[model samples]
Target: MQTPSFYFSRICNALKLAALVCLFLGTSPTWLHAQKSLSNELRAASEQFLATLSSEQKALANLPFDSEWRYDWNYTPRQRKGLPLKQMNEVQRKAAMHLMKAALSNQGVAKAEAIIGLEYVLREVEKRPENDTYRDPENYAFAVFGTPDAQQPWGFSVEGHHLSLHFTVVDNKVEFLPSFFGSNPGIVLPGYVQEGKQVLKEEADIAFRLLGSFDEQQLKKIVLSEKAPNDMLTTNTRKVSLEKREGLSFGEMTSAQQKLFQELLTVYLNKYHVTLKNQELARLRQADMNKIYFAWMGDREPNRGAGRGHYFRVHGPTFLIEYDNTQNGANHVHSVVRDLTNDWGEDLLKAHYEAAHKK
Candidate 1:
């Protein structure tokens, strides 16, 4: 009856004692007023959507709103939201989707209406010819760093292809860690599965019931360096000192494997914001839950679906969560959550932009 990480660990202990005075006046006035009000409303909706482009639509609908277009995913977030809806026309793509629905959340406005339904699957399979539909969810690019209005610190990202989202709202108290949620043809079968079936499969059935409560040599010292480690040990690399917490340690499991590893890392620290998912499970209960590691990989056999032996991963110390249906057979899924020092807490947004814009 009460789970979703036990109401996200009781709303992360009342939002970590309501941000204990900017965590003892260290910074965050609501992330510098949601990063100066979302950098002045998406830089004035990217300067009125680049004053209605037409120098070849301002060299193919401009860019800089995002750095390296959120690590380019070979396009298709509706051709990156049609490069600002093809350089904005319908009143500047409804004023940049009303400044991204006033800074995201009708579930981030259904991820920009699923990138305009992936731009009608790239204008109906990019005019067929064995059409791959020339993928493009605008490579899922959208960024607003430091300024919106709720907690003075701000970030909203919807990165490419299979999509990733990161949300931060520090001072007002809401941060969804190193958050990345992915799906590639995760069930877009008959014309967008009519918005019903999203097959992450309870993110791989709660990590195969927490790695079937580990035992075979505690799942071989947390199944390290197998395959799934290429891109997210908080890939944004914040300095947990890249690898070598040397896997497996929830005090070396078994209290029913630490209650299925705290109900599968409280489904990724409660997908954030119950006071930073209770100050990251009170920092894994002050680093003593018998250390903490619950790793698993490539088809321990789940209807052998995550493809190529269907991989899985989960790491610990204030969290890292991952899932892969190994390409597409397990019905394509990629999951991510990291707080290995608040990534995109980009060093707490460069120490609140050097103690308030070091003028």
Candidate 2:
């Protein structure tokens, strides 16, 4: 059995050959014609971003696709591998943001920007100094792995405090996985920069609605623990797994309950472009929906204190979604969507490799 990375390398070589063949034949390959329109748009944005960078900045922003750092992703307040937004000039920053926008829906972009803006709210809440290390919205970094070419395998990442978005493209196929979004002061009450603004409001509210619909007997199966965990169980791990599958199965839910659960799932899935989102939805529809589970932990009621400790997770055969508001007195929010077998494009790479090798 060969590793996925090994197949990834072989796929790159095969794609390079395919590119040459297409050029020689004066015709586009089927894969090229079949490429997602969004992938092409994103590649153009990525190239535009690179064009705006100085040599030094470009060096910092680009890295080998196979570098160990490719998997070194996290949603924490710390230094990262790519160029931080603060270091980019206004033009460059705009270019970088364009690349980001290319990968997200309009609503997703709004939510991401709102999450970044919350750093200021956190600074005010903590009363930190001007040079506060953990509260700068511009602290986010952007990095590209491999060259941004439509015919080859490459990827990009935007990561920083409370947000980590990754995209991998190969032969025009895009993989959006290991994506994270978080918020401090999850719900903004009065007196903040944006009063009554909740960055992840839909995520929390829908879960609440779904849980509320559960009867006492159903609740018994869904509430996995008396206490909510302080953070997501799969935080920043290269490989993620849950110790147990304890929750109410999708098969147990009423039709209305199932609809609500799916609506909640759509909130997360909608983070990507429609092309990619549709592809993901198609794969999800093919899965064993009856095997999916929904689990909640911690207090169901609203918290009046400085923070509320609430957590919930939706687990399916191929995907896992985790949302937690147990940190910072429950004022902070962390949520992640992971494709169990496809994070970092493992499945895509594998299939591409096998197909290319077979040919």
Candidate 3:
């Protein structure tokens, strides 16, 4: 029987020929048409959600464009500073969800909902009280920053336990970064709701498959250490900068390995709305893929029931993707994607401020 890599290699060879022809002819990918109007869609959704908020709720849900809270995000199960679903009426909560639907793709929406629902699983596993608000799914908070305008700069965030998502828009372009999604009891054990399920299964499995195909020399280049980090190296930091770059470069990979890496990245990128995904995908296609690096630590193989302590990161010039499963006997997972230059719309805001100062 042929290995998974064999199939990937064949597929990649076909894509390479088509990609070369497109590049030579200066033609764009078909996804160009998919970028119809993410900015307008987001503005409409934000407006609708805000309209449902009562005056008191608006007081908490709305803030200035430059508010410090715009960047204050966390994925821990703690009291957050936004209008939570628990405080919103059914109509308001539905609107809030609509806003999320506008920002995330179908896959992303499912993951977001699943991550929220995991709180119930946690409540049962931890044996919390019926009235306990600590693990409440409704604890996720939603907030909009500045006014929603088609041409103006503004942002929004929905953050809570195991999830922190942020979106910034300037003119008609949207920037989403520092996005996080996590799972406790990463694999749902028997007797719980959604038993024997893993929301982030693809993330680990795809990576493991790629690792498994590597030879001893390839493993030495990628695996940094035998012990994994306790959490993401850049956990919720206001600003992140990695002084040292480590791991195996994409140029070093075989054709099949490169295809696997691209597939792994698509799993993360596909979480966003198509417009955003296409926009980013276009940038990636034009980027120097050889600069991208893949690094791993801890177990070479995945141990399912109670996971093995493992971590991996895809670091490149433009972005960083990190995944760690070291807590809860390695059954808890923390994964995040951070934009190197534009977390919290750093580049966009900078340009806006410069243009403002000129006038």
Candidate 4:
């Protein structure tokens, strides 16, 4: 009997083949367009997560930040240092923390661990004799918006440098968009940096692993440039543009190669609650998956120091995930998970709230 891993292996190989074929024929992976729909389990898992938020925590989902400002005080950031996860005596904090722990896949856990590593970096940086900077409270704070109770649509932001997760839950359902994760000093300076490693090696390696699978022709479209893009799209914007798909398409790939596309899709969407993940999966299926893109530029490798300039962006229908490691050996890293149609639970929560309004 073939184990699940065996099946996964089969699927993975099939996708690799299909993805390559599309490139050879000048076609993109078309299966990217097909949607088998999210399983009930996925939806249920997401809902279960939402059911856990406390009223206080929901109020802090996300305060509107200025589009022009990158590190505005309005939005939570690691440098500002706001809500301490340890200080939460309220139910909201417990619920949010719980939901986050429960909702994330193994990969998500890995990412979260990477984020925690950053917090430690700041701490270690403060302890250094040469450094004058000390960690501030705002460097790692959580803000609540709306009530956290199931009755009230609410959310919380677990934020720090290059690591912000804005998750909104309404009526026992989940909506996580504009979720972000980042790392600066992907590695510490080669010297005097033993305590703090770049902290973003995993993310870079995993992304490149999938990207490396591509053949020569696929590499051209996927590698937009040697430089990484500025920011992950959809994270800071309302409506986004998909005009970048001119040369990229999945329809050209063989059926098996298309599976690789699916794997890529899985890597990002799986970061949130199952319900929201399902929605994202659905959106990806409906959008021109064949038109999705994987763009790169700048340093193809990572290092201990923040690189001078480097960036990369993956943009496609209902899909936009960007990463920039231009700071240290392309060190400074920024990656965001966005929902083009709805960010901050704008679409679903507002509608759900309106429909249930007593008025």
Candidate 5:
């Protein structure tokens, strides 16, 4: 029997072959329509954003594609390397937002904005000092990797407290992984600016509804433990590794249960542009559903006691989705979607390098 490594090697080889073919094809119509459409749009937006920045701001915003900094991603509150929104003038900030809007779907754009807005909510709730730098919405940083071009490899990242969005475009294919969205006070109460707003409402509610539908045996198979981890197992790690695959398989679930699970998956997958989302959906459909596992930890009830530690994750051959609400008295939330084989466009970059060296 072929080992997992063998299968992974096969996939990589196939991707390399596809990359070579694409390189020689001089831009296929399907590629142009599906991948280049968004790539070109984002490239144009990125150029416009750079155009508005001064030399120093441009220096701060641009980085080499292969820079180690490209892989340095975090959603924690800290000093990061990029042009923060606070430093941008009104025109520059608008251009920066336009670049961001070009990459996300309407729903995704809303969630990102809401996550940034939550900084204000945190300021009021925590009653921090006036000079508290961490709670400012404009603290988010934007950095571009390489020069944006349709035929070459390039990418960008928009990261800040509670959010990290990375995009890589190569030849017309785009890879989005290691994308994160987090919220403190996951569910804003009636008193905040956006009262009763839950940025990740569907992510939480849909999982709970699916868990509620599970029978005793199903729950026994799915619930890995009663205590949740303080944060995701892969928390900001460059390479993700899950210690075990323990959970109820998708094949074991009822048809309705499976449907609900798929819907939950869509909440994360749909955050990308339509073309990328559809491509990922196609890959998911083709994957071995029996290998997909849904595991839950901590209290099953929602909005229960403070810091009760509720967490769950969906793991499969290609993707990992982790949701944790175990910090800040169980009011904080952190969720991430990672492509097992392609985070930071690793696979595509490999293929591009090989194609470039081919005699």
Candidate 6:
């Protein structure tokens, strides 16, 4: 029997193969229009998860859909407002994971779990006590903005150290953006149970490949600086704007480089379930690719063995993707994908509210 790792490792290849099959068959994936089905599943899983929670837990897990806190998101190991896994019992924890599985693709779920598990490695490296609570795998908090309903607008988020994932559903359409996935001890060294584990390895490696393919002239267009930023430029902001566009646009890339760029994008987009994945990819495909920009900073090489820092971002009309590995001697990584116009499902919410007012 093949393990989950086997399938996880094949995500990029599978995506490429799926694209080829789509082109050959002249039909979209069967799950392309499965948004409503996914919405129903999310509703059911959320209901079940809520059912397992006590009254106190429910109070913490549920929030008004219009609450300002819905936009309050972070990937730091700090106190959060949602119901943490540490507060859940065995049954409740299982339900929580079911909700996660409902919202994320297998690859996305694996990355989240792996990021959480890194707490153990970090604790060991820091020589923390066995009972230390600072570096904890169970601190991830789950919060539901508004009740889960099929027709009404609602949202869900699961966040904690190195992970902040948000999803919003309205009128059967789902939006996933302003999503963050990070890794500390990004590459686990030897002397650990899962040594050499890099949860966000593809996110880093793909960009490296694209950068290496560029010639000196090509590099000048994309490379922003020799020093990487200490953190994401847009760190946890509620809104994202496309300011002065900088870096190399897709129109400038050669055919081969463009292929690498698209593959790099698929690594992030395919993290969602097929429905959301196809929906977002279709929208991006329809956008003007010439306007999409790729910028780089810091070391040309990744310096995998604790050396210089590096950072890059893919910014376009509809979305933005930022990746940074400038902390902890470039051993920690932070990557996020944000929607420029519809983050937190603002576009849907605006339309929903506007229609209601008209009614």
Q: Which model scores highest in lDDT? A: 6
Off by over 4 Å in 5: 1-32
The sequence of per-residue lDDT tens digits that candidate 4 reaches over residues 110-157 is 666566555446555547432323333224555544434545665555
Off by over 4 Å in 6: 1-33
Cα lDDT computed for each candidate against the true fold? 0.53, 0.85, 0.86, 0.54, 0.86, 0.87
Model 4: residues with Cα > 4 Å off, grouped in runs: 1-82, 85-96, 122-138, 188-202, 229-243, 254-257, 301-310, 353-359
lDDT of 4: 0.54
Q: What TM-score against the true fold does each predicted structure earn?
A: 0.35, 0.88, 0.90, 0.64, 0.90, 0.90
Instruction: Give per-residue CA lDDT, model 2, range 1-359, as digits (tens).
Output: 99999999999997886664553322555434434676788889999999999999999999998888889998888898899999999999999999999889898999999998888888887788767878998899999999998666899999989889999998777888889999877887688777777898888888999999999999999998878999998888998888666799999999999999989988887877766665666566557678889999999975723555889999988889999998878878899999898899987788778888898
Q: Please identify model 1 stretches exceeding 4 Å from their true place.
A: 1-134, 137-147, 150-155, 170-178, 181-216, 220-247, 250-291, 299-307, 315-320, 329-333, 338-359
lDDT of 5 at 169: 88
User: Candidate 4 — worst ten consecutive residues by lDDT sum?
Assistant: 31-40
Steric clashes per prediction: 53, 3, 0, 74, 0, 0
Per-residue CA lDDT of candidate 1, range 198-272, in tens? 535455677777777677787787776445532333433334343645567777676776787777677555543
**Candidates 2 and 4: which is better by lDDT?**
2
Q: Which of the two, 1 or 3, has more TM-score? A: 3
Quote model 2's TM-score.
0.88
Let me know the TM-score candidate 4 reaches against the reference structure: 0.64
